[model samples]
Target chain A: MSHVNGLPKKSPDMNGNVTITDCGDSALVAKAVGLDAEAAWRLVHALADALDAVRLTGGHDVVPTYDALLVEFDCTSTDHATVRSVLAHEAARLGPHPEPITPPRHFVVPVVYGGEYGPDLPEVAAQLGLSEGEVVELHSGSDLTVRCLGAPAGAPMTDGPPFPKPVPRLASPRTRVDPGSVAAAGRQAVICPMPSPGGWPLLGRTPVRILDLHSDPITAYQPGDTFRFRPITPQQWDEYADLSLADLVDSAGLANSADLVDHHG
Target chain B: MADTLTIRTAGIVTVQDLGRVGRSRYGLPANGAADQHSARVANVLCGNDERAPLLEITALDFACVPSSDILIAVTGAPADVTVEGGVRPQWEPVPVRAGETVKVSGIRQGLRVYLAVLGSFEADRLQGSCAPDTILGFGPALSTGDELVLRTACPPLDHPFSRIPLFRLKAPVPPFPTSWTIDVTDGPDRAEFGDTGRRLFDAPFTVTPRSNHIGLRLQGEVPRRVTKGEVLSRGVPIGAVEVPAGDELLVLHRGRGVTAGYPVLAVVTATGLSALGQVRPGQTISFRHRTLDQAVAAHRAQRNAIDALRSRVRTAFDALRIRAPAGT
Candidate 1:
């Protein structure tokens, strides 16, 4: 088989591979061919990076999702054909296998499970045929990767390893889910960075402020980050509650205090 | 700086500009003026930058008292504009004296209206946009007793009310068709619906009350999809007509989330999206398929029309020795 950059070049017949298509007059979509979460993430990152390089010349934005990367450009200045050509050139440079521009960051998020913080915990556990404690163990014990930030600003969709049985979304969506609520739907887990209506089943609430508008880097988790839930007591949740973005960053130790300087500075 | 405008009866008003561009990657929706055409027109009438922040008022009544002499224009939904009890024409630039209360009510058509001043509104901005994204909890919604501050000082102009030229153009008037015919093109998931996708053009859909800036939920037969598997969540552009399992057609709008899981049957063309923005609840809508080239041409034409109008306004301003704000 022909190989480029140590990764096998996707054949046309491959069930789940990347294919580029026109999304609209000013946008193009590169969709991941299959249902595999890992493959989807890899393709999304690869295409997003390729498009980012292309955007150096012209392009408004490139949004990466679980299974696709949407590239938007100014139609008046650059046409879809030009963007496609740029993508093709970038693909040649990537050579099938492309390394992530930045190494994945890891986070340990402390979550308070059950009770008011997690209103749907018992229901989700019952549907999964597991005890409430077992449900918590299953969710927190597994390491998950940040698929992408979506649904709302700073809301991170994390891909958990396949569950023993498929989990379903809530038939009736709640009008509001509290901010910092940890929720699960199907095979994916998500952190509600803001209070918004959604169909995902609430599993817990984290004290971490994932979507801090006051912060320099508005979100806590970025794509390609690894995270695991650490069960915390309600008291611990209270202790961490009301912490500012600067405080959270300090606790995470990911960025230096100097990096927390305001935009005006 | 110019004195702030005091809100006397603040309806559902929020500051909006051209929207936050290039922030979809951070899961931020492009929340801007629901009707960009009207917003741009209002700004042009006021001699402000096209993307300057303006008040987006919903169906409810809005009343404000200016603290300084200001030039203003109201566009979008047809509404009665009364300046100190004197009726002023909608979609035309009108000058108001300081302390004169301007009341906008009796909306005849459309759902929202744009109110633009001669200069941009001073407000907290996120991602270079003043538009409020309630989901993200950024930017404030205008309320009774709130004050609206302007970015620039406005010195009273010495122009007579009779001499202020009204640059009239063929703009769409509302009592917006009870039934709307919108144009659309194939979406990324168009093939997922197979032959059933053709049904989209055959029937009319009613806009349900359970709709907001996020999307318009249509009451109609859900176009059937042959692919029975879960669609991975992906980026959804504005004007994407998605069909969830509930058998309702949901057309994403300006405030749509960054990503969605429903299968998108078609994407409304740029002109179609502007038309969709004016649709009121209980309105009936039908879709017509257009080729990609046709959609592009229509978008270009609409943009060119706006540019021509802007040029005319600029020429009028130059002739009258009126100073307009710089480019957006």
Candidate 2:
């Protein structure tokens, strides 16, 4: 990691680096290279926070991937040099643990475990030497940070529980994992909001709709948001059939209540 | 009475526009039309705003009849456009009488064609875009017998023979080429393929028939990885030239997801993407190296040409006292 202008940065930004690259003429990326998952996540969020604090005309998105921050803009209105310069300025200002774009929200996602919902549940449990109940208990009891949200859009990528051993990826990935599939690999967990090809072991399926393309901010679980998976029996699945991630987030009972104001949470 | 266009013979059709913006953070691709250049030209020629939804016709016969007389534009590809057996030219807006079927068939030289009615065509919209997610088969997939209601009953021109000379003065785009030369810049994972890296530019690639809106699969000299490592799944831009394990070089199109783990050796320029969008199956493409600045300049040139046309049309509309259709 290279220091920005040789200035000392506190905590997350300390020893963290960002290498900005141009993807064609339309998109720009600020990648955090040679960092672990947690460190990369922090550095990316910091950069994102710094950039989002200001208003940029012609900018389309500030998408946070697992280890990179992608900023897309309308090239007709802005040039790559202008956008890259702004990115560098914003990145240089990320001195420490930066804030989030919006106040962090919490959600309790209800999921149904095993059998048809999770074909790999039995194999995963056997490999981990934990019973199905124990696996569910350990996974549902842990709190996870929404590390990133991307791929097919609005899919929440978060942290899984500390298992005795890291879960291995599937030998052959599924051609299409249906939406709302709760999957886990190593210490990471992901909720598929859209049907996509995935290698992570499917632990369960959630009834709640995590992404609605028609709505802005498609998913409630942005980076820095907190969520906990609560296991449910198959019989109670229909109870949350029509619920969405927003429905639960709006009821988070935060200080601002329903308003998505910045509360530094 | 609702102005409608009833499909007589439908091919693979979908509604497209300039595409959705400010939705990528949610993983939504900037999917509007596969060939934005043609789509914009079609919309602007018919005096519709650039964002107005139009039909993107692929590889089959497509015919529709408007409930009322309206002006329409056909652009992209070298498809034959005919109105009630009379041949009409592409690129320039032409007046179509009510009940006369406008048919686009015999598309031999290209992959896609854009059809824009003068008024707004009602289609399923998601996040303010009519462009469907072709990968997931989500959104409106137009088919035979489907009647698309035009929200605004646009007043037709005097007659087909009374075509506006100003719009007609614009010539049709040149015929699609059998061979394409695309410009590309080095990608993030360009170093992955060592010796074979140069093969990407040196050899020619053929666009395979298995291609779709998501990506164009190509058959060419496979750039086998010299050293293999798990490439981190990072956010990718459109026009990425990915090397999959199966030896097929995949050039991602507009419908691809925002993030991917595949090794991207090069990224096609904006102008290259537009050209690739029109490439028919079995057509050859040769990649040429370009600096980032050159790529941007080329794209800007292409966009500037369209912008100039847009302004000219705006002035033409003012002179003709034409108003945009409703529900734009």
RMSD of each: 5.8, 5.0
Chain A only: list TM-scores of all candidates. Answer: 0.80, 0.77
For all candidates in order, the CA lDDT equals: 0.76, 0.76
Steric clash pairs (candidate 2): A153-B26, A153-B27
Those runs of model 1 whose alpha carbons end farther than 4 Å from true positions after fitting are: A1-17, A33-40, A56-58, A244-265, B153-175
Model 1 RMSD vs true structure: 5.8
lDDT of 1 by residue, B218-259 (tens): 998668888876666778888888887586898998889888
> How well is each residue in A1-265 modelled by candidate 1, as lDDT tens digits?
1111232222121223556677766677876664355556666777777666545444777778877788876565566656665655555555444556564556777899999999899998888888999888988996677888888675888885345775677888898889889998777888888889888889899987776676645886678766678899998877778763234322443452233222102
Steric overlap count per candidate = 2, 2
Candidate 1 iRMS, in Å?
Answer: 1.4
- Chain B alone, model 2: TM-score? 0.93
**Which candidate wins on DockQ?**
1
